[model samples]
Target: MFKRLYCNNYRGLVNFEIELDELTLLLGRNGSGKTSVLDVMFALCRLLDGSAKVTDSSIFPERTLTRWQGRKEQTFELDVELDVEFDGSVQCVPFTYRLEVEHEEGGRKARINREILAANGQPLFRSDRGTVQLYRDDHSDGPMFLADWSASALARVQPGPDNRMLTRFADFMGRVIVCSLSPASFATEAAEESERLGRDATNFAAWYRHVLQENPGQVAELTSELRKVIVGLDQLSLVKAGLDVRALMVSFAEEGSKPYSLRLDEISDGQRALIALYALAKLTANQDCALFLDEPENCVALAEIQPWLMEIADSCGESLPQVVMCSHHPELIDYLGHENGILLSRGNGGVTRTSKLKDVSADGVLKLSELFACGWEQ
Candidate 1:
């Protein structure tokens, strides 16, 4: 699904690029900057959603930013270049944003240095001072600010002379779902949460119940898939997940329970993981989509991983939709047959260097555990 990824000046990543394939699995030890990779992908979606500022999308957050306050800091930059093909034609899209911070008479200030878009191999738009010129097919108008603008606003008033992959990728994210783990997906209604909780599942119970009543089919399908992921899991059920009495309430499977309150804490880690997996799997099973699971081993038990991976490979393996995950599971590597799908993280002095397993040598493949244990090297 994700053909390639390139990022610069983003936290642990300075300049990075790698080729990706369907079923790509990125493996690295903790702090190998694996989580950062997921962060960047989500940041990409946020940009397309117009919910995050370019600076906010950066790895260098304002609160944590500390770079010799007395001296000038080099500009922070983020660039995402992608190759996407749709309807039989491939297109190259690049999104680059640059910001410079300097002390002005003892006060720190930030200014944009480069904001440009290139299609194929040529520049479509460049912003010297926030002046953006998106191409003709672009639905964005003028100098857009994702931090403060809405999609409807951009679609209604964007300049028509510039184009960037973000233009289409932005549109794709609305329909594309990328999530880690939110409580509501498996929360019990009476337990104090709902389904489809906004991004974080802060109010999970109410949303879960409401959706079950509104779209019972979606919930039923999700439950069915979850049961498959969790071996020997039969009679799967959700507690206090939907709404009740025109007001929000949780539903439970207990005897004589009012089904008004459900808590995420009640579920096991394995169950919670399955909930996320199934929810996304259900999506791919229904639409032309791709699922990205970052470090799926988080809650999924090591024993169940192989069966689960095979399950995904068999069910969606042929067509319609697909699933690609980044994992560090050894059984997963062995089950997949070829280490070619594996992507190792390696670099010079840096803590991360991610590339496919197909590139690893005999030692690298034979002693995979040692390689993962070594973390990173020169």
Candidate 2:
């Protein structure tokens, strides 16, 4: 689970730090940098996992630098707690990963200045410029080499018997899921199984196919939960659509009549969102995964929001290790704000700031959401 995050000079986030819990809620107005936090996490995960490089403009664009600040360097740090096995015993370890990227020539180009990974305040991997130093599980230096400054040297490290700790951290980062579901972009057809869901979940069918293959027994549990949110939902199956292609099909059971089926894309947006949300909770449970959800309540019915939130909340710390969600819905705010919410606000010059929801005092008559809606929480 992620323990804390520190970011400097990345868009509106300047010298920002936030402590995370098993479940955290990000609440604020549209431009409070709630989504920016999620974006940073997602981009960092991709960078560390070798899926993206430091120079990828889509992930880290020229605009990544804070506009008001003249600094050319951006820094990010993540602290994660994990139960790691070594020396024939399992122990909880604290790992810290830090990255610094510098912009050059008026911010048109960027390169990694420093990248470091430490465990229990001991360096396991450190890179400065093109020089790299790799350490072993016993905290002794193993190798020193020069790597590409634009890429992650840690990602390129192969798994070895003495580097289990480093490999474990890499695997954990790879499993982190960040998403803002757009039901309209979801495809009904899947060309092949996907290892992970896309950021927008456009390849949901492909990812779902992979989930079903990995956890066949969980299908029944997923269907049972889907029935609660999607009325009359009987079962979900993948049918052959074409050569090496499969399509997701949803079946509904009706009273006094034969069950009817429909393609996944044929469902309403709300229904599709509900399906994705439920699958997210069930499939990823107990899998040592971290989830970041942006506005999951979108397209979901008012009555359904709390139940889904409850489901995700209950699974945290046990089945799911960490979850960070962003939302402004009353159901979410009233239910989780006081306990788990982190309020993000823009300070002078639009630099993002963080505060606890419980710290804000409000009149007894107004709920947390009401206070926020009426600008009392501001």
Candidate 3:
């Protein structure tokens, strides 16, 4: 697993490192670099696709400034170094990924400032002039490939549990995806693995039925967990084919069936949210993959965050994927135990700090909601 991650001179962040584990959460006020952190992580995912490209995108100048916006210490530099428990022992993974923008007379493209990767804390690779390598292993026989095949390529590769695990991790990003805050319309996903319905989750019903036909026990567990988090969610029923299929679809017997649709739009907003969550939890729980969910507590009753988040962790741990989430909600912290959380924040003139919940006072939970009383409303 990736044990530590550090970044420097990237957007508002100057330099930062955080210990990491399954189920990490980034929290803080707006403009506090929370989204930037996740954006960088997602960028890494996007970067791994070999065909991806970097272009100068417009972010406000005031917003573009780092923690030391007008200070001399603020050289445009981003160095990423991480520690990973590779081969039963911890090894420092070297990273020197960086970018720089020119400000002279109508600024142009952000120069490909720097890119490098080192295994065991030593520079084995670096992008200079023009190049990138995102994935590589000191111990693997095969070369990893990501579509965005330039300067950041070595990062495209990571050590998976086995060859299969490694391949699955690199080949698919759905296992570790990010959904922007769209509490209203973010109801689904496109199926990456054929078993997966889709990100929009258009095939939720199909996938659910398939799982039931193949993995009934898991489906049952999912139903139970969903019931706990959703107030009126009664037992969910899927009609098996070769028998009964129509006039029912997947019925929430616990609630009024009320005729479901392809989009499952007939249900209450909360039900749709919970259904999406539960479906994802079930799909990802058994597999050893990772998922990055931001503001997972959205749209649900405040009281259910704890139980739902716990179920998410338990379900993910049960599956093959390791899960990490970011939230601005306190109830999430209240519900998720310390072991399940790694608190993420930016401090000290924009230095990012990552610490475990267990490290905090009294069971390691800091009552995060109250801490962000004014900053979370947006």
Candidate 4:
């Protein structure tokens, strides 16, 4: 689980830092940098897991630098706590990972300037430009070599008995899920399995296929939960559409008629969102994966919001190790603000800042959402 995040000169997040809990809620107005925070985490995860390069324009464009700051350096840091089995006993370990990217040639290109990963204040991996230093689990220097300046050296490390800690950290980062679901972009057909879910979930069918293959028992539990919220939902399955293509199919049972089925794309946006949410919560339970959801309340019915929130809340810390959500819905604010909310605001210069929701003073008459709607939070 993420204990804290620090970002410098990334978009509006200049010198931004936020402490996180098991279940944290980000509450703010539009353009307050809530989604940007999620983007940074996702991009870093992708980079370190070898799925994306630091110079990938789609993930880290030149415009990602703060517009007002003339500095060409952008820095990001994360503090994570994980429970690991060490020396035949499970122990909790604290890890810190930091990366600095420098834009060159007037922001036309970017490369990693420095990257470091430490466990319990001991360096596990360090890189400066092309010079790299690797350390083993026993805190001894392992290897020193030159690495690609635009890619993650940690991702390229080979798994070995002496480097289990480093490999475990990499695996944990690979499992971190960050997404803002766009059901309209969801593809019904999947040509092959995807190990990672897309940031927009456009490849949801392929990702779901992978999930079903990896955790069939969890998929069954997810289907049972979906039936309660999704009207008449009987089962979810993947059927062959072509020689190597499969399509996600949803079955519904009616009271006085024969059961019917529909393609995933044929379902309404709300139903799709609900199914995705339920699947996300159920399939990843107890998997040591952290979830970051951006505005999950969108496209969901007002009445259904609280129940799903409750489901997520019930799973956090036990079934789900950590979850961070961004929302503007009143149901979410009233239910989670006082306990798990972090209020984000922009200064006059457009720099983003964060404050704990419980620290904000209220008249005790209006709810947190009401205060936000009336601009009291600003």
Top TM-score prediction, candidate number:
4
Model 4, 177-265: lDDT tens digits are 99999998899999999988888988989999998888787987998899989889999989999999999999999788899999999
Alpha-carbon local distance difference test for all models:
0.48, 0.90, 0.50, 0.91
Q: Worst lDDT window (10 residues) for model 4?
A: 53-62
TM-score comparison, 2 vs 3, better candidate:
2
Cα deviation of 342 in candidate 4 (Å)? 0.4
Cα lDDT tens digits, model 3, 273-337, are 67767766775555544566667667777666666676765655355345666776777765563
Shift of residue 147 alpha carbon in model 2, Å:
1.7
lDDT of 2: 0.90
Candidate 1 lDDT over 1-378, as tens digits, reads 355566554555555555555566666655666566666666554544555444452422433222323333324334434455555787655544433332234333333444454444444444445444544434434353432211112222332224334455444443334445554343344443332333333344444454456556666666666555544444333433336322332233444543333234555766656555554555345444555566565667777676667667766545324455666666655555254354545466563566555555545345554455564321
Instruction: Point out the worst 10-residue segment of candidate 3 by lDDT.
Output: 71-80
After superposition, the stretches of candidate 1 with alpha carbons farther than 4 Å from their true spots are 55-60, 63-113, 122-126, 138-167, 175-179, 182-220, 228-264, 284-289, 314-324, 336-346, 363-378
Q: Candidate 1, after superposition: displacement of residue 289 in Å? A: 4.2
How accurate locally is residue 71 in candidate 3, as Cα lDDT from 0 to 100? 32
Model 3 regions more than 4 Å off:
56-108, 111-114, 118-126, 131-169, 172-175, 187-262, 316-321, 337-360, 363-378
RMSD of each: 6.6, 1.3, 7.4, 1.1
lDDT of 1 at 21: 56
**Using lDDT as the measure, what is the rank order of every candidate, best first?**
4, 2, 3, 1
In angstroms, the error of model 1 at 204 is: 6.6
Q: Mind giving the per-residue lDDT tens digits that candidate 2 earns over 140-196?
A: 999999999887889899999988889999999988999999998899999999878
Candidate 1's displacement at residue 321, Å, is 5.5
TM-score of 3: 0.62
